[model samples]
Structure formats: structure tokens, C-alpha cells
Target: MCFKHDRAVGPLIEFFPRYCIMPAQIISGSETAKAIREEIAAEVARLKTAHGLVPGLVTILVGEDPASQSYVAAKNKTAHALGIHSEQVTLPAATSEAELLGIVADYNRNPAIHGILVQLPLPRHIDEAKVLFAIDPDKDVDGFHPVNVGKMMLGERCFLPCTPHGILELLQRSGTETSGAEVVVVGRSNIVGKPIANLMLQKRAGGNATVTICHTRTRDMAFHTRRADILIVAAGVAKMIKGDQIKEGAVIIDVGVNRIGQTESGKALLAGDVDFDSVVGKAGAITPVPGGVGPMTITMLMKNTLQAAKQAAGIE
Candidate 1:
């Protein structure tokens, strides 16, 4: 059941109707993230000029995993391009948990490094929690430190997790009124779903939305999704949410990036939890798989690093 709303976003928006097929506006995360990065760059320049402080981000990669290496490289490249000092610390897969903790401790006490990010999926032998706990909360731009998490839970000033914060930015920038809206998140990972749900529930801008989190044990997933005014899917299963599963004119945010298969030439391709083609007409607005949540994640990391730098420099 599609309802008509005054959405005058013609230049960069589309509205889907019930009787016929019309694509909803495609929320371009790439475009949003780029705009944000540019803004952050300007701020970085100002910080250097007025306060003589350069925001520095040090990303610690614990293994030679190809995907992790690529992600860390992309983050470092973006940080430098935005005028933030970036460093990469690579540790062999066999590095012990204690050794990694020592490195984290060194950076924690180093005033030059504002943000310390330990890339996820650390080696099985390493205690990831111990390493995260070792980083000073002020330098924990990844928002994994217990202190930061506690502050966030209490609605205090704190660095937010990148992926979830990115999702919040997308909703706010895209003109989605999260307050009082019915939001359904289809995952429970600490990274995306849990944080997003907590964020949306907060009584803040782009928050206060009635949210429901569904997981594998959900008896009827489609029932909850169909009721959402804003649906955020991070189930990690490619193309899990189909067209008919969503309500007409619902806004969809896809956070899961899974490689379903390959192209005809055997090149790798990615897909999202929400079926893009199928949900195109069903949703009021939706994000594309690759260009959706991916860009925003890194951009938010930059924002966190900038904030950390401000804190370090004693500049509110």
C-alpha cells in the first residue's frame, strides 16, 4: 500500500507507487561519504592552521590477510588524502596477544596518535578483547574500548562505532525522519546492528525511532520487516530480504556486503542482504549494495579520528 507524500527531491530522488513500478530514490552513500570527507578535510586544515595540530590515525593490522590489508590501506589512503597523518602497523599472524597489547599501550601513551584502530578478525590465538581494552578510551576511535562503549550506552559524549554511525549519517542526510519511525534492524552483531539499534533508540537527532532487531531465531522475519517504516538489513546473507517482504514505500538501508557469485567473465561481484532489483520499487528509498554502507564506514572513522584529535589538543 503506497501512500503519496510530498517528496520534491526530483533532481536526486524517486518515489515508488503501488499500482505501477517506479523506482524509489537511490540513496547514494558514496556521494554522502565524499561530501563528509571534504568537510572533514577543511576542518583538518583549520586545526593545523590555528592550533598546529594534525590529526593522526594509526591502523594496526594483525595479519597478512588480503582483505584486511586492502581495508587498512584504503583507510590509510583516505586519512592522508584528508590531511590526517596516517600510519599502518603490520603484525605477523603469529603475534601473541600480550605482544599486541604492548603495541597498543605504546600508542595509547603517544600524544601524536589520536586514533588507534586494531583491524577486526584478529588471529585466533590473540585475545581480541584484551587488546581492545588495552587501548586508551580517548584514542579508541574504533569505539571498541569498554570505556567508550559505556559512555555511549549512557548517552554521554563518546566516539561511535564507524559502521553504525555511518548508517545514522545516511538516514539523517537522506532526509529520513528517524524520530517516531518504525525501524527494523535484521542483525545483532556488535558492529552494526546492536549499535544502530541503540543509536536509533536514543532520544537524539536521527534517533528515537521505534526499533526491532531480528536475528536467525526470528520465527517470521518478513512479518517484522514488512511493518518497518525504515528497514536496516545487516543479516550478512546476500539477497535475503526480497521485495514482497517489505512494506510499500518503506525506506531500506542495506549494511551486509556478501559475495554471492561472479560475473560472466569470472570477476568477483558483491551483493547486499536486501535484493536491490526487487526492492527498488517496493521501498521509498534504498541504498545500493557496494556504494551504500561501505563508503560511509570509512568516512565516519575519519570523523572519529578528527574528534579524537580535538580532544587531545584540548580544543572542545
Candidate 2:
């Protein structure tokens, strides 16, 4: 059921009773992330001029996994383009957990490297947790360190997990008010779901929303989703949330990137968790799959690296 406007969004509607279909405004993460990168570039230039410090980032990849290599390469490219000193360390699949930990320790003590990121999905023999825990919290720009997680929970100053922070940036940059909004996040992954939910519940500019997280255990998913003013879907399933499942004008942020098929030329066709075509006409605003949350993740990691550099130089 549609409701008439109670707030001053614009002039009153002149439509017939009971229904109106307005297409959702597309929230382009590519555009937003580009704008942010420009801003980071300027700050990087200034940091060099005044403080004579170059923000440095180092990414460690454990294996030759094609997808991981692609992601790491993209990150290195972006960091270089943004004027941040970037390095990528590649190791064989047979590299032991202890060796990886030792490498992390070397960077942790190296003042030249402000941010250290270990590309995930280490070899089966390597203990991923041990490697992650070995990096110093200050240099843990991926924000997966236990110390950083604890600080985030307390609302203290720390590097936030990249994807979650990116989602917040997308919402705030799009001028979506969250102070009293009803936000329903679908997923429970430590990477996206848990952190994003906590961020929206904090008492801050991009936070203070009433957040409800739905997981596999959720009895009535539609019941919670239909009531959300802002719906963030990261369940990892392809086109899981359909049009009729959402409220009339809810803002949708799709974090899932599933390859449902391939195009004629062999390019992969991607879709978000929220079915874009099904939800477009009813949603107030929505993000597209491949271009939505995907671009912002690495950008936020760059942001964290810059912040880490500033902190190391004692420059706020």
C-alpha cells in the first residue's frame, strides 16, 4: 500500500488514489568513488608538501589465485594513481604460516609502511587467523586485527573494515538520512554484515539508525525487510530479494556480487542480491550490482592507508 507524502520532498502528488510508480534514483558507486579518489589525491599532495611524508601501503598475497591477484593488482594501481607508495608481496602456495607471520612482523616494525594488508584465503596449511593477528594493529589497515575490532566495538578511533566503511560512505554521500531510519541488513558475515550493522547503530553522523540484521536463522525475512526505510543486502545469493519483498520507497544498497551468467562475448554478467529489475520501479533509490559496492571497497582501503600515514607522522 502506498502512502501520501507527509514531508516536504517536493510539490504534492496529483496522481489517482492507491498507486504511483516512481523509478529509483540510481546510486552510482563508480561516480562517488571517483570523486573520493580525487579528494584523496589532493590530500596526498598536501601531505607531501607540508609534512614530507608519503603515505605507504603494502599488500601481501599468499598464493597465485587469479581472483586474488586481480584484486591486489587493482589495489596497487589505485594506490599508485592516488600518489600513495604501494607495494605487493607475492608468495608461493607452499609458504608456511610462520613465514607469513614473520613477513607481517617485518612490516609491522617498518615505519615506512603505514598500512599492511594480507590478501585473504591463504593456503590450506597456513593459519589465516595467526597471520592476521601477527600484524600490528596500527598497520592493520584491513581492520581485521583483534585490537582494531575491539576498538571499533567501543566506538573508538581505529581503522574500519573497508567494505562496511565504503557502504557508509555511499549512504552519507547520497544524502540518505540515518538518524532515525529503519535499516535492515541481510547477512551475518564478519566482513560486511556485522560491521555495517554496528556502524548504522552508532551515535554519529552516518549512524544512529535503528538496525535489524537478518541471517539464515531469521524466521520471517520479509516481515523485517518490508519495514526497512533503508535495506542493505549482502546475503551473497544472486537476486535473492524481489520487488514485492520491499516497502514502497525503501533505499536499497546491494553488496552481493554473483555471476549469474556470461554475455555472448564471454564477459561475466553480474547481479546483486536485490533483483535490480524487480526492485527498481518501487525503490526510492538503489545501487547496481557490478558498479555499486564493488568499486568502493578498495577506495576505502586507500582512505585508511592515508589516515594511517597521517597518524604515523603525527599529522591530523
What 10-residue stretch in candidate 2 is worst by lDDT? 9-18
Error of 2 at 59 (Å): 0.6
TM-scores for candidates 1 onward, in order: 0.94, 0.95
Q: What is the clash count of model 1?
A: 0
Give the per-residue lDDT digits (tens) of candidate 1, residues 110-178: 889999999988999988898888889999898988898888878889999999999999999999988
Worst 10 residues of 1 by lDDT: 9-18
Q: Cα lDDT of model 2 overall?
A: 0.92
**Candidate-wise lDDT, in order:** 0.91, 0.92
- Residue 128 in model 1: lDDT: 84
TM-score of 1: 0.94
What are the clashing pairs of model 2?
A: none
